[model samples]
Target chain A: MNHFMTSIFLILTLQFTGVSSSLALADDSIFVIAGKNSSLPQITATDLKLIYLGQKSSLAGKPILIGQNESIQESFYATFTDKDMTAINQLWGIVIFTGKTDPPKNLKSDSEVIKFVNDDENAIGYVSKQPEGDSARVLAIQKSTTTTSK
Target chain B: MDLWKNIVFSCRLFIFCLSLATALATSVASELQINGFGTVGAAASDDQSGYAYDIRNKINYYHDTKFGLNFSSRLGQKWSWASQLLVKRWVDDTFDDNKVKLDWALVSYHPWSDLSFRVGKQKLPLWLFSDYAEVGFLYPWVRPIQEVYGITPLNTITGASLNYIKQLGTVNFELNAVAGDSKVVEDRNGGIVLLANVKRAQLLTFSLIHENFLLKANLGKSDAVDVTQRTGSSSYVFPQLKYTFASLGAKVDYQTHFVWTEIVTTHVEHLSNMNGLYLSYGKKFGIFSPHITYARYWSHNYKSVRADTTTSTATTTVRVLSYVPERKNKQQSLILGLVTKITDRSNFKLEWQYIDADGYSRDTTERSTTTGGVTTTVTSHGNTKERGFFDAHPRGEVNLFSATINFIF
Candidate 1:
């Protein structure tokens, strides 16, 4: 009877832990972030697309610089722009060839992207985790119909 | 002397700017970036005489291959400057001289995301690919069709442009207005030189981009002047020739297939009216993409009249009017090509083109006549001989094959 009771307890503990971990994983969402002092409080998915595609150069009244984390670039673009890394790079080739705009600066990790945004008031970046600091603020993104969570 | 001086000055200025940029890059490193693109291509045609292809081609790399370098610098938060330098051998020249040219040097200001302004020498966006026509890696074909792109004599303009962009839900709209001037020099028949001057050129474009579709419309007008001087003390001037043009274009991309089409009409005062249409379709399969294109060029008859007055011995004046006719021509071409991406930044392309042209040229006939025991010869314009593409050589079909390797860095 004691052995059966211990087995039940182990099974219950495993089930509870699995559910908690899955919920925790689901809560870690990616976000588009900017400097705390930036005038831009929120951005739409269309605006983000234009900014990253080199169609628009600024946000609000300030010229904007774009930084991307290499680790999450594939997922970020796939989820937000409805494109893969190869497609994004091809689009940038056209943009750069036109002599109208330059490609974004690439960062090695999400922390680097956050650091870049924090250093430049006109800079914006994307990361997987919600940044915890006073230098950066997360902007509300109005999702579009095409955007899909990966 | 003035032209040479200007050229030398431009060269010196370019060198100085390049040195300064390099210095700044070494010192700061983060504010400046340099990139480049190049094409090493060779093309051949079945016709031994010549063929008017993109740029120029005669089975040689000197005429078809080109290289370019781009420099971009960020100045503060709202201002930036960029420049591009291109080097290529021209079709009209036997040797590579005057090959180094400045493609664009512009300063851009963006005060808001919706509005922007630019000034300086910039690309005249007359068509969809006009801004990046030289970047072969960005396009599927080895090169754009010459029959369509060759119609415009000017590619870049010196002036300013204003652009406004707005997004509404799933659709995006862009409106662009440009005002500029252009000067071009042409070599006629490889000998005579002609100068074309364009003034007060204005262009307006509107484009709407949706999920997988794009629609664009353009309208432009300009005042053109052409000057031709002969070896003797004779010169001709065609002044204040008005030119107006309009075009409509649409592009669709769905899954692995893409289609692009456009139609253009140009009217030139005291000259022939030209109409052009082009359609292209392509599908991607893994690393390879195959495409086909059809293009047509048509022109209407050109007519001009001149009046001459003569005085007789009795003080009577008579006026005689003479009319000149420039025959019209129609040309069509079919192009098949394949592109394979070697990597993310490089590609290889092979293309084949077949062209058909029909026109008539004036041929002279001579006759001998005897009047009052004297022999005289008379010559008149008679018989029309069939001409080839653009009234070129043997009036028949033309085949061209090209292979190119393009890359961007």
Candidate 2:
């Protein structure tokens, strides 16, 4: 009886299928990194939230953006920013449907993010581990990240 | 009337121009992005009188179902173009015959980080979520509060808008101005539909957006030209309409909880005036979120005109009898819902609503008397039929159950 109930529960709950990326795994620590040649501002947690939410693309310098939905560290990065990948996607859905801006580019791996940031002086992305070899510079979250941005 | 007759021609001309412009734009563009959203919903209502919210005694799986596709491309750092195609079933329209409506097809130019100019087809920016109301996954409930959101039919327009974004301390403020014309299609029967042409439609919206908070104000005005549709021999019972509306909205969003509310007042030229408000609250528990809302809509300022002529002459005296039809549409409801986030792009939601409404039916009658060498007629309006907001005749109240699977990619 217990096994039958478990099977029924699984059938009911796991039947919903979505286009999920295999790269979505929550990591230990996430860092917001940009190109070393970029003149990024002291972005608060709120400002970073706005960037991920597709509200603000730039601050002080050129525009900032997030990695694509299929990014390997997207879940960890969103969690570090006090958000979930679903929440971020919902917000971007609103902005994109309004024709305000396009969705993020497909950066399937952290190494791709680091490479893109290294090439573009205006680009920004998040990674699970701290980048090395002066490839990218991690900006300081000016406000305390312990508390949620909102 | 002429504009209504020439709607097909106008739409063709606009489509040609837009296609030409897109061709010119894509000639220099190299990247194209496609995005879309869809919802499959089923709803049921227990109402003995008639249908309400498109739900009758049986389960309805098509009323709330919809699909949308948006294609966008960037021409350069300063120019971009976007267009959306939508297919959805509506009340009075059968399944497998949903109309493919062009929600928006516009080109945007951004010369600065804070300024943007767009021209073409755009959604009227009336309320906070009115710009993207079709995306069911973005809202807390199975659908937006129908009491307030269903007050107008001018959903999309073909015109131009200017947006100016500014930053003030900790808040991001945006001022949006829209000017255009719209043709709203109103479905009356399976074959007969009313087409209303809105002229000189203008709207202004001011929004202050924060990471955890939002405040918005909107003002809009429009005039409708009479255009009746005829297929075979059926005609619509639509009136020539005009309206002006003003609204205010606020939202407090957090990772664990959210509170949202909006209030609006609308004054119509020949129809009834109305006021509506809805307050919603929701809290998250891991993958499950439970939400609740209280909404109320009422119509007042019922207009009555009195004209008296000579009813008695010579040797006979006549008594004047008047009857005026009462105009009303009112509703109040409590909605409870639950949402489960199944994945980053999909969600499952279930909702139950308890609604109380009145004033949707009326009867027209006239009293006339002939005296001496003249004839007199007295025209009046008022009847005693209590029809609810979503039903032809309900059993005083109603209970509705709904479920949907929403997704975007």
Candidate 3:
């Protein structure tokens, strides 16, 4: 009886550890990044929402160029905009089809996004992890009711 | 044959211009973007005498099928150019002649981050979805509720506009003002086609947007020439007419639930007064979303006068004849729809609508006349007999079912 109790405790401990680690892995954090020379140091959640919705054209009196990573767009939009990828695309269809504004430039990977942002002084982008580029800086996002960020 | 020749010529010219623009943009601009959206849809109605516009009992694709292409070029920092071309088959018989048309062509200048100016042809921003009505992938319904959208006869105008956008904390405010002119054509059962030339059109819109809520108001005015009497080789030109409209709209989205509402009133001088209302609610669950909408349209105090002229060898007389006064009509519809996202770029939608219309009559009139050397003589005339709204379905109720596949890239 003592051996059986010890084995049951060990199994429960392993199961809890495994579940927690998987949750941590699945909870990938998204970061908003801008060019090193950009005038915007940080962005509020409302402003970010407006920019993505094509309701605002700039931040801090500087023209904004938006870049997107195709790989993480689904998760990033869901987290930041509270919208799925399909919803985001539909919104873009309205904006673009109306000739109101152009959509963001789509890049294949985080490296491409980092490169695009670094080349354009007014550029902004999102990524799952911090990019390995000195020319791009991660802009701290202000906490707000509409956005969730890490 | 002449129309076909003209269509071919127009197509060739458009192709040549497109190629030229592409070459110039590739050589000068750093980037050019081309995008397109299309809908392949079919609809059927249960009314034998037809229902809602020109739809009949047969499954029809021409009434709602449409495709559009957009081209945008970024010119330097302060300037950009955009153009859109749309091909649609509408219910009107005259639209069959011009299936392909230019939707918008505008050159915009952004001198400041919050302000911009655009000049050229543009969509008349009257309602919430007016700008992108043909893009089926954007909206929640299979189509915009017809009762509200059908009231606006003009959708595009040659115009110049100024737009201002400002963000304050959690609220965003936008103002748009436009001045333009347009020509609208309407076909009345292939017997009479009215051409309206509108001038001095002006519109103003204000919107306040929160994170998930939006409030909008619009006011517009225009002067138009009623050219209906000139359709049958008549040289007489009617006087200029004036019209004004005001509308309010609101929308809310919380979690997976959404609601939208709009109300509008229009006054056409010496013709009629019109009002419309639309309400919609929807909820999203994963890749599937279902929505329901109710729309109503009412016309009050419709008035028109008909004159008759008779000529003989001895006398030519013109008499003031019958008058239609204080006529009223109303149409209401309820729609239930389901939309499913098949992929990132494709969507499939199905909708069922029940429509009830009242205060309308169907009539047929016949006139026989004889002409001699220099005088025309009136021989006989038959009066029009009023009948019910639907000959086959006497209740004036129609059921419409539609399915569409929409895609964007």
Best by lDDT: 3
Q: Determine which window of 10 residues in candidate 2 chain A has minimal summed lDDT.
A: A141-150
List per-candidate RMSD values in Å.
11.5, 7.6, 8.8
Q: Highest DockQ, which number? A: 2
Name the runs in model 1 displaced over 4 angstroms. Answer: A1-31, A42-46, A55-63, A70-72, A101-103, A106-112, A128-132, A140-150, B1-28, B53-58, B91-98, B188-193, B227-235, B305-325, B362-391
Using DockQ as the yardstick, the better of models 1 and 2 is: 2
CA error at residue B172 for candidate 2, angstroms = 1.0
TM-score of 3: 0.80
Off by over 4 Å in 3: A1-25, A141-150, B1-30, B90-93, B229-237, B304-317, B320-326, B361-395
Q: What is the lDDT of every predicted structure here?
A: 0.69, 0.71, 0.72
Relative to the true structure, candidate 2 reaches a TM of: 0.79
Give the least accurate 10-residue stretch of model 3 chain B, judged by summed lDDT.
B385-394
- Alpha-carbon DockQ of candidate 2: 0.39
Question: What does candidate 2's lDDT look like per residue over B1-409, in tens digits?
Answer: 4355246434544564465467547744445666778888998888754333457667777667777777787676678899887766644333234556677999998777788899999988788788888889888878778778867656788999999888776688999999889877755433445567777788999999876788999998876645455444644333456768899999888869989899988876654587888999999887788999999988753443222234555666565532223567788899999999887788999999998887653534455666665666666545555554564656767888999999998
Docking verdict class for candidate 1 = incorrect
In CAPRI terms, model 2 is classed as: acceptable
- In model 2 chain B, the worst 10-residue window by lDDT is B301-310
The C-alpha TM-scores of every prediction are 0.78, 0.79, 0.80
Cα-based lDDT at residue B200, candidate 1: 83
